[model samples]
Target: MRRPSLPAWAWVALAAHALFVADARAAARFDAATRVFRLDGERVTYAFGINEAGQLQSLHWGGRLADGDPLGPAKSLPSHSSFDLSASITPQEFPAQGGGVFTEVALKVAYADGNRDTVLRYVSHTLERDAVTVRLRDIALPLEVSLRYTIDPGTGVIGRSARIENLGRTPLRIDQAASAAYTLAPQDDYRLHHLSGRWAGEWSLQQRPVSEGASVLESRRGSTGQQNTPWFAIDRGGSSGEDSGPVWFGALAWSGSWRISIDKDPLGAVRVVGGYNPYDFAYRLAPGERLDTPVFYAGYSDGGMGGASRLLHRFERERILPGGGKPRLRPVLYNSWEATEFAVDEAGQMALAEKAARIGVERFVVDDGWFGARNSDKAGLGDWSVNRAKFPNGLKPLIDKVHGLGMEFGLWVEPEMVNPDSDLYRAHPDWVLNFPERPRTPARNQLVLNLARRDVRDHVLQVLDALVTDNDIQFLKWDYNRNWSEPGWPQLAPEDQPKVYVEYVRNLYWILGELRRKHPKLEIESCSGGGGRIDLGIMALTDQVWPSDNTDPFDRLSMQDGFSHAYAPAAMMAWVTDSPNWVNRRETSLDYRFLSSMQGALGIGANLNHWRDADFATAARMVAAYKQVRATVQQGDLYRLISPANGSPRSATLSVSPDRRQAVLFAFLHSQSKGMQEPAIRLRGLDPRQRYRIARLGGGALPEAMPAEASGAYWMEHGLAVPMRGDFQASGFVFEAK
Candidate 1:
């Protein structure tokens, strides 16, 4: 007896959905059949190569035609249109870095014929973390197009390949390499702002200028082909193909842009497109031959940073749990890196635990220095076993005590590293990435693991699994302390070694996936030294990210601003660093650090145990204030109302709210001239009709009395202003919807 068959149309609809849903097949661990792909396996399971929750993955796409066949003949696109186009060649897959995703759709237009050229339309959707997106669309009446995605180490930005090929027959000639753009919703307060250009190798971030200003194109050596000249863009035109778009690209003084190029024409081979980033240009394709290679990333973030956050959550599912549940992060957490350092003993841990429990901190994390023979950074990185010197009776007692005290216990681990001075390195010298005969290059007092090798990745996984599976560890701070240096791994093929970046990152995803599945509720925060690895690719795997190395409140204006450019303020891991400073002379009032870092995931990076009673009182009050505003800030629409980068030391103001019902504003009085009057700060993106009440944050800190300095008037007539008479200070204002 057979069940009734579905209607023919229904069957077809179901099949289309299945194929549309699955751009490619992954392992059983991930059923691409569903929108959510759980990245849990040694084999590649996620089409998204990397998953750094905050922002760490950079994407690239490379492809070519099977035959040197120009998509000879022009045709129309899928949408309502009459004008059609053709392509030289179309490739299948894009490169993956850690947890990234991209799909190339090919539309076979009218078939190639002498009357006209049929089009092979190539388009793609790339997810760089959850926020950044790159969308590529190009059509040639008869020309070819190509590109590459390369990371520029110098600038910490990504650049494009410099070549485009002609897989067609006849001498292909393109008028020029042009037509590439990026799109964003206009509602976002942030603009596609430009940074200086010095890092040509990496069109990622620039502090040095390759060029500047509007109406001009900037040129620098390409990161991919290392060509003599390349192009970049800022903001320009509208959303249209064939040189009409908002992206500022191709040659000039105006800063900001990924690489792009133009091509005059190449006889029968590949011509040059925008170079440096795009490898080369399209050429005339001969039958049975194909055009080749590309590198690029296309990403999209809806309402600036918040939009990016949502996109990230949609993919990674990293969020705070309403009620404690499996796969949820403990509401309160404490770590000991800056608090106790390495010199502390068990008594110190116990004391910290005591304070932690009082504050409702549900977990206590012991950062580095508790593993192997490590009493300090000089030893015990690769050895995962507990150091008898630090914990004579093993981690069990501390775990038991923390549990008894009503808190979970977590620890830090840098599994992708090996301290040459440790036992692991001695046993497997070959496990470190290097040419068999070359000297091992160490970084951060350690060497990168050769995850490209089966054994090395397996070992890292085993140790990690042991820590999670064998102990009562509830969380992990997965730290990658260094970047890739001398990135040669003998275990991989020369061509495939290029895949190492994607592979190394994939290896990381594998470990995280395994641990998450087994523990089901293990929390992880991905950290890189401090923030070098903060990108979308890495964010997919972890819950949060460290925004930067500098934690000064004043300095945060720039660092946090830069981070918020591609990441959400909510995901930022900001801590209160020591004052007068632990690393710099920037002495920010405790009030400032707490408020600024409160814009993101809040934590105490400085020594909390040693804090003066006054500091604790101040913190308790401020943390409470944060609790009130945290929801709005985390889920509000961010507006870049003002910027110090615009040369106004007067201050910068950022506002947020769910439906404009409530608002929070931070206005800092930067710099003070002997006789200069205060500058008037204009506010935008507000409902002028609605009134708002104002109050200084943590105003309750003074129980004896409310100082006029702490209490302030809320106004709409002149907006809000803070004094800057002598040395500058930071102030925050709250605007409640009236």
Candidate 2:
């Protein structure tokens, strides 16, 4: 049967109507009669309502309920005592500091007339397909706040944030402002898990019980410090495992100093407040000026910690990263830092580039000595001009050579820093961050530029824009080697000095965004003395990150395990460096180092000038093997079969493709005494009905007892064992489903 075709506009109208219907099904719902709002994801639901007092109150947040499930209207809780009023007892969605509320507040303001109290109440709201915005105003003053809620239907992750505006004629001072507050029902036992570490050691998982007091995780060092990360997970009564039980996790998307407070009140209710740190922080807003806080992303997972991480990973890959959430794969990079640290020259760089290309390196980076008089970190930081002495013919010759060798050229840059002895500082000493008549403290022989100033921000953008425009650069190893010693903005008034903390970071983000907009093909790696500035904020702007300065294979196993709890392996840039690692002076085999680095985005930082023929062959083989399985390793479901924490003697990890057609397993042994046999590792996230063929990687035979092929059910149930018999040994295998 043939039917008459409709007009183009009619077809478009029909398609639009179908889309509207689908969106309506997934959209947030607000009941005007009961003053209740509900947001539903695939497997999770979040509900809240307005109380009689006009304050927004939390209702339920957990597993999804049936469409007709009844959620009663919001009501204020009774006061426990005179000190704890009803306002404090009730779980306010966004609590202000006034109204007898003693808990961590979402907003704190000081009016011009010496009033510091603020009580916010619901005024109105607007809803979209997957988002909702609610407006609240102070009961007396002309201060307004807007709360935003966005949900991802596929992963059941919700994003929350708030915006503050001043409607009065006079200026208002904001002392404390948080993005969102999440409340959890009382449980028998609540356990908190977070990540913490230092310079040579980062991403160490720490667990503790949630007591009646506040447990604060913060970064006070301008950038996201290594001392703590802005990610957390809470499990009820320690009932959750790697892949089972209930867990709630969240991360704040801010690269500047931030805070997350987990407070378990005396009445047994647990509340989490996260946002910009109030320490040495104040923002003054005049009439009509507004400030928007960073988004706080969170989710619920009945499948446990592993499930929580997997959901977060998928959300980040599809929503947070660049390229409209579909970021490109990280290339195999070779950096010349270890080989020619401060002695970089055109000839030396080209020679290293040739060697790198021979081993399948797709990008060649010249680190730390191509510009100014940068013989060492002590000088030549702010000077962005090419060093005529090192590169007599300029960077074009070296870049052309690298391109001819079939690799992209990259360079290291630190635009946010300047050496006191550099030409730029000598020209404009007032450009760096400093206070009047106060001695400027320098870290790593450099001072942080006052990016808060428009002049300084423009200078940085111009320099970087010219660098990429003049050269055929494809990637940048953006490095920030030190923290802020004294953050100040002398150009602004005394009352506005505290705004540096917020403006500095905003300007940094602006510069990065502008650079990407100008050069669409360029990619960047965010490095702040190694894992010091990695967060959802920076990850959204950069392609990958350097996890740590300590490349010791053994230490990396533990670091990688902890890192996987919050971040995707696709953004982790692991480098295979020298043995007898500079950090620990621990010697490990080259193969072990390769295996460790293969778990993430692979990069080689070894000094090829010192390698033997056997080393080259080994590296070439490992690089090829990594190329074959990188998609699964970088963008697949990671299963931690054996954890390497607490100095465990053995560790193993498995990566299964999203389609379940392939899997890769990497196992390591620290030391085996008395021939103690390790247990077989059970596989996960595989299709039970399909058959898979086992294949060995890095040229080794499979176990004699293992079969060549088997059903996924048999492999997952019975497991497989790989032979390991020495100290610092590693092996890997691939399973191809047929």
Candidate 3:
């Protein structure tokens, strides 16, 4: 993996120029003589350069530097032992497989001539206002790799990805590929934080010390599995806390089968490599063909875990979400799943809609059982037509009724799945992901359609297009109930069958993009049997996401807490369902339920048909109260004052508006025994100079000694006391700047 040496004078000139020429206003800069590139954000700077051996190396990735910080060239580290070569010790920006490296290679390929090693060297580069693309070529092969770097000016987050091209005359197989590898500076102790859980229990924050080996977080279930999310944060031991300390965080903007490996070399160099999972993964590129990796976004925060989350949330809202930097607020939705699961009909739905409207539900959604013979999950999954038996006049009458009641209409749809007994499945049995002579596995009584196929992709796009076009549908609860079983693409050559992992997701994204382009007003929610398919990739296409199917108020508190670390509240949909919840039968008070759901995009999933007059009144009052502070909850900086994790008896959250005009606080007490007293809730992210008027939601009494109005500084310093006496009790307050 050696390369021709550059002139001695050239190296000296580049080093001299890079050390002296640094513009504070420039987002990106490159030193050609030294072959160094630097991207500067508001508070962070990422710099990399080529070493003498012609490999791209990471230089600096932390706090912002001054105009002349003296960042020298990328030098390869000396080998500590015979087993650890210089190439393995140096933190190459995008390492290839042929350099005697053993940590984690970013790119690995199998050539047509039976070669399996690839060593990429710097070739050329391109620079832009906020981006830089560096080209690398195989030392002796026609395989070229282009690495891209972009930074968000407001949130100091850097996005890295790679493009692999086959410039040879024959085809080549990519055995392993990653977006990019990030190297962390040497430190004494590093603790890694990630999210992991099961179907009913998702987003459990898990942490461990970074040891002397590799820790891999991945999803091989075709979509972003509920087992582990594609996000990670690391902080030095002893200094990490909820609100203050140094932290580094990143998330992979990929929804398909993906992997992120955090490795600590024996020499103590820590690196993070992430991209398409190499588990049964392969992509064959023909001559002149290319494959692009997903974007891996990383950021640094000196404010601790809370600071890291806040930065990521702001970045997702302004950069990743669908609304061009200003997405719409999540509407107060009423889903009729709990009321009537498989008994949905026009009369029943209209009655439910009428009751929902009385309670001020802005959007009425009829979930499941409205189309085909979808009486249950066992049949009629792929049949996209309306059921004549249930809807004799189609969805028009119900949609019109909902509109007339001053509410938008939404429907449940599972376009990527088909039951074995469905008409679509029977007609095109070959459309599923199956081997020629293998049994097609079924989960939830459905099989995943081979969306990687062009025909199947077109069919799904066409049906969804027509459904939205024919009806006044404002939203779609797009769900994928199962993962891939026999992910075989028999239509393509046998050698290309393994490409399903990449093509399936690409087509899915394409279909969603096409649907949105066709119908500008239509909104979509990504649900995969609960928080199974949520990530930056899916967030870019959909408006909101169903975090989990288990809507029990108490269970959701922990899930929502973990969810907020990586995603924005605007995209997290929380629903208030009937108590004596089906999942755990945990019965909570109506007010408690409302307060829990009100933390995020609020929704009602309770059976209004069974509710008494008192229930309706309570719901109406809560809905009205939520509307008053909806903007702040949906689009504001969140502060988790007291975490509900580890069986904590009390939990509290505060949402402060972006402009600092208003702040909303919600506090919950799991149980109080022996008259245990709780501490006052101090708020954050409020302007200390402004005076605020405190008002309780739902007409609750304030603390006896506390004033009704006070300066933000006084409130923050003195705090406010709220009552917490019984189990499952909740309270909310609105602090309006006066």
Candidate 4:
């Protein structure tokens, strides 16, 4: 008898089986021999242990914890002085403002008895399949704090939060409360990476070295303002590049103003604390009442900044976004904001809709100016009525025409604001958020509505609900365009005046919930003058976000890069608008614009009426091609091969399908210098042994060295070289397994 022959896949399966076992053991494991608990994903691990003092100690996070005794005690500490007496050297899991240390505390609570001391000591802990809850109590006060840690099995993202309960007869005032406190072993060379921008320049990446003092990244302008995003990354030794090194990162899930502080002690130890901005913030908790902080998600990666981003992307898609049913694919939408601006009308919108449908647009959104006296940004806010002058028969005609063209219809609205010139404001001047005697400060001629008021909240909800129900609206671009100047709610008591900041966001969330409950089929996009309100809180209800008001493809490249660090591509709505470009006036090719926008949730904001025949033909073809790879690009693992920040003329990105059968690559050349050579573009996340067929999407001309077919291993190892030249040029390709 002949020996049985095995197929090639048999060996592949054997190799994968070992990986599966290793992954399972490291995913979330407790080593009884070492008395340590570890949480691990494919490329990272986090380990910690409880010490003799019953406090969490020896916290270490990095690539993998395969060494011995990773849960050892801290070997270094700052000298204790008569002025600041912080004695014990072990890293704290959650420090409170009592005795025991002068380092920054994560929680600060005040009692009705006028005592402001709070010393939390660990009492007990319980571990579940995906979560662990640690119980702590003040040394004297009758209060209990529970710290919850939940690790996502797929992305290894640790979701952290705190719940504080008043176990005493009297009430307690929480002066400051953070969701989690993360401590790192003594290291002096760590660098902090954060995002900072304003209005049209949101989410611009910024980096600085971590010094001995505290570095605070916060947003105090009501919503998650354009000033600072509540996410950060720490890279030690300034050596972490886009694709390699040790990087620890985190993001808060609150839509209201937030704060994250990184405090580096004199001894080189670092503690990261994050949650709602406690500045001018105080929460009153009566007896038996509990306050829960928003989720603060943190993760570690050895694969550098890119790896940390990929982990976040996966977690956001699988766990954060809400659709309540089958996830909808983001359509190639055509927005009329740039096309018509404040001059939109029924006939004008119908003409654009005809051209949009011809170019294979899936959604047609009529932007501003279709409402009551809204000919400009100076008036007509907070009025949800259709303008009879613009549309004599209301929105039914435009809605019918859009549906007839086989496209979904969307409307733009800034429901959280009111213009002083509008009838709504005249009828209820006190409805705006303002002090009784303070002069109202208007931005873009608008004031924020007091959403915290019950009547105001109910009215906004009712108006939105009626619009969706009556007009058969499928989508809404909900916008909040201004920051709060004097956010005073006279309706509430003086003690509750500060409550406006918190209640306004809570009311916004309530309105969103009610809207979703009524119109399950309707999708919403959160846009605050663009990207101002993008965060985990709003993301839970909205389908997508407009990343910026500046849509210049070059500017968008960096903007989109910074956005992907904390968000998924599926939720990033990128648009290809008319060029010269509206923001920068940098002339770019039509293909370049489309390719840039295709990197995320694709949309077109260019005026179709002004497009030439050739432009329309190219757009139609590109739109069809985008639909073919939309799922892979939106949901696949992202690999930042080349960054645009390095001053190099070229930038490259790759995305691989989850099943490992297909991949897409996007390369851009901002401006090539003389005698520069085309760089090699490597691929990732593929079955190395399998053969794949390569096809170009829209790269002007193919490189002379291009091959039609190659093995995945060869593609990843040797890489493919594409010919690139000229300023503002882009190239794209798709690889499919044969």
Candidate 5:
């Protein structure tokens, strides 16, 4: 990987003053007696705060009630609220503020009517040399929403960005968001706009592969609600536009605010910023850090996903690429289903790993069958240990074999669920989560682990900790297969069972947090029976998620599109030719298969040993081309090239790396009609100034182009020749911009 040079403007700021030009504005009050931050708005009063480190606090929404409204006398939904609050720092984490200048910040919400409400939030603060941990113990009212503001390390401006977690019992469900009045004391222009593009590259875990898969695709229908993706740049009391600058104010929680801001950059570009990277380095909030005082930033992006990235880098210009480096992973790799699946003998397992390594892969992840009991997916899940029957030689040797092949080894673990037939379940029935005297239910041949139990938590910690300490596992695909529909925590009292939901989630966080801390090099991925639990809430914990189990290229066209609404292409686990098309009725060609997977994390989920020589040759080229322009795909502004075809030759393209340096364009052609002409689709998200080298996988002519505009492609005025053709399934093209 190569390092990117800092912008020349940033170099100038490096030599400029960093603290003397600090500005402070006081509008809301932080109250010590009440322990809540209060922000007064034109229509309502916003008062709220959090103290729970890994736990949750409460939110109260009240204002002058109308006579006709029922909320005041009897109960109604308009003016009442009780939200469970969480921290960047887990609440239960015993924090010791080796005392200094640490301050606390939070969000406050109030209801005015059914269609109106008021919101007040704080921003994440910047990091300084004299920084130390300070857990937010309590939040009393009138304690003006503020943090110990520090001068930006690179730009000298006082900056703060934080995340407010809504860990309530039921999802609060945000409809339309409106800002009351805000204190516009800092900048003369209170201009707020919609931002576009990628985010600043300064976050602790800004995994490019994950970010690319984590986009929030626009919603046309209402089956799946819109994703609460946080953006930077929106002024309270001003008209919203498409321009951006610095996001210096506002204190809002993450789930509660989908309407973030877009600030003005020196240029007219609607630059985006935020997401807790400004104030701290990329260290897991472990041993020495405070627990409860955590936060996340939501910005405003007009260019949708593209806008968000632009706003992110605006404020975080200096540390965009921490070491200012180039990205390597393009979310492309191969994963085996059995490294942790039903018991498989060491010889059989080694064969699979060996084959995967030989298939032009950077990561060879062993999935489920490698750990626990006898052969079959029905046995050991939470056991987290090697079953001698399958791997007599132990995991270290297997990992060593993978390492010797020069490929990264990844393992699987369902830390939050277990199988009743395992040792952990047999010895401790209490560890199994179920209703009293109720028949046990099953999903994926496994039972849910009662994470709320202290003993159960201890067992999980022990198992995971050892997995990391024992083998040379570089990545752990942590999976949670079900939702918390049946609220049952055996250990908690009947009355306290309601509290179990929050507790279980907290314990899970604790376990993951501890693991990341103990093993900083550990790469964690969270998968929930495939996209079952995809949301911003989980992104804070894991890097990427398995978008779905249906790896069929045809089915993925819609599934992946649906997932893009709230996630990026980087977070989606796309496999190249996994088994057969799980949906529809046809064998998808490998070229189409590779093109299908190219849109997201590229991986091979099928038996690599079954691949033909031609397949190997094609796979090698795709991987090489992928590495060449992954940064453009993962971090550059994204644009949809072709409209989705219901059943005809469906095709689309994503032009990644738009600064004109390098770009990757992918297109997939589905179905070949007897008398139809092959579609030639024009590309999107490209720079007209930079010429690109276009190539095909098997063999085809390169796509020609006309002209483009800042808004979008002008050539498509109509579509072009399809990127690929065959079983009418999938195919991709590589367009490298230089």
Candidate 6:
């Protein structure tokens, strides 16, 4: 009963040591003898093996299992006549739509011999560190398929893709091919969660119960449309809260048209499949030709939706995004789109640049109207050359002014779209996507360029290259403002018309890659009228994405929540625009707007000229505060404490730095009730024994009668109260280990 007590510092050190060990154990691992793949990041396991019939069967996918415990005890085959109708009654690793198995199929191939039958049998497998490839072949035909699975041990994100080769004598057509098919063990109740919206209102999260039949979400607009996002999560109806329960989730890494199907079979078997949209899609594989599907990533989380999101965030930082290494802290930008849209001139831009720099902006972007007959959205799009009338001395004068003002310069251009009124379209009408005899349909008065064509692709690259070289451009806002209509290439043979979808994306990637090679320091943002093309495919090449055309901060709350479900905050470009907001005309406080936009890569899209001296001061101060927490907010694990969709009066997000020493909280109270008390929010992802100092950042009062410092354990257990009393009020705080 008489042991020497350790000092406070010693105790803190011991706690930090234990925290490191716990975090280290979260990495994923695979057991060969047990045939169990443990995704320890979420404490989940996936066990699978080939049955005696040489078919890959999914055995287990859920919470971690003991090393020697068998997953999914063997069940005898049914004596009823339904045995033939079911595919062995076991979860299939990759099921085809044939053979009387009525569940969702992952692949459908059409052969030249007028047969569409496919019966795959496991042939061989190769396993490497953190990756595996399982080969399968047709039981009768000469078709070969291989399933590739790669896992990022740190994040427990399993990436799955398929490779199909035409080993037969004739060509084969891939009528329907999914990147991956995931099946979860039967649960009492399943709820499917996804995002759906249109235009100014995009990425609105919606959750519905999984029913007996099938529910589908897809984009057939030839691009990742604003109508639907290609990501989903299924909870067992156990917990609806953001930070609780078991949830399974996946997202397709495709920027083009895609489809995701959630099917609940008769036996209550739930399966999710996703890949390229097969509608108007037919990939012809010639003899010896092989097609590789995009990667589909899936993960399991016992800590619920928030856990799944943080896993994806870490995976994107460590494994997905590339910028010489991990993506750097995104610069705080000031874009002039809202200020001088289509009215951009050297003098006006220079004046705006000075104001932006005065407000502590790190980047200044000149949006639209700087190029080719472009006084309006209807005129110059594809013409990348500067408009002499607007930029009389070229973009050089404005760019130099921005550089001298201590900010990098960026320009906006829709390289993939051409206005019918533009010089480029007038000279090369056939270069646009159109059938020989069909009328060309235009959106935004612009035609989609046939990037699938060699000439068109080359022209886009040349124009962009010259712009960058001549103007010393450090950044380009590459936009795709319209969807594909009359998608056809008459220059190609009739049989090869479908190649437009495949080749267009390929050529875009090539152009981006080539430009990157030439200008090593150049940065680009991928925009499709905003949030139209935000997907992992485009994310690989671009620095960030404009989530939506609506910069109303309140709307962005839900939009960003949905966007971050499958994407990292670093890739979600959120802007702070003027109030009496553009779309909703809902007036919000400047601090509220700043805090909302600060949740992601922060940028200012407000018309600086309309701002008063106080507004400028607030903007400058908030930008400085953002800089202090930029790295942590962009790269840390995100914990959504309160959901905006729940119609709550308040919403909060907490970001914990990689190290357990720092955390930042951005809390907003949309509207306060007459006698409502502020909620006490619990903090996560911290060393419990370590004490932290809580300090306010912007214009917000601290909790009433609360201490400025407390232990992490106390913060998590008892929590800290957020102040209340106002409509559209927001606050930010930082917690540092004391």
The numbered model that scores best in lDDT is 3
Model 1: residues >4 Å from true position, as ranges?
A: 1-233, 237-333, 356-363, 403-408, 492-498, 675-677, 680-691, 700-718
The TM-score that candidate 3 achieves is 0.97
* Per-residue lDDT over 180-283 for candidate 3, one digit per residue giving the tens place of the 0 to 100 score: 99999878789999999999999999999998879999999999999999999999988878888889899999999999999897688789999999999999
Greater TM-score among 4 and 5 belongs to 4
Worst 10 residues of 1 by lDDT: 95-104
Ten residues in sequence with the least summed lDDT for candidate 6: 71-80
Which candidate would rank higher by lDDT, 2 or 3? 3
Candidate 6 lDDT over 412-521, as tens digits, reads 88899999998988999999989888889888888999998999889999988888988877888888988999888898766668867778887888898898888888
The residue-level lDDT of candidate 1 at 689 comes to 70
**Candidate 4: worst-modelled 10 consecutive residues by lDDT:** 69-78
TM-score of each: 0.63, 0.96, 0.97, 0.91, 0.61, 0.92
Q: What is the lDDT of residue 329 in candidate 6?
A: 82
Instruction: In model 1, state the lDDT of residue 542.
Output: 66
Stronger candidate by lDDT (1 vs 4): 4
Q: lDDT rank, highest first?
A: 3, 2, 4, 6, 1, 5
Cα deviation in Å at residue 221, candidate 2?
0.8
Per-residue CA lDDT of candidate 5, range 291-315, in tens? 1222332323334333444434332
> Could you tell me how far off, in angstroms, the CA of residue 214 lies in candidate 2 after the best superposition?
0.6
Better of 2 and 5 by TM-score: 2
- Rank the candidate models, highest TM-score first: 3, 2, 6, 4, 1, 5
lDDT per residue for candidate 1 within 557-659, as digits (tens), equals 6665555444555556677667876656867778777777766667766677777878877776776677677666655555555655545675554555647
How many clashes in candidate 1?
106
Model 6 off-target regions past 4 Å? Answer: 1-42, 66-84, 699-704
Q: Which 10 residues in a row give candidate 3 its minimum summed lDDT? A: 15-24
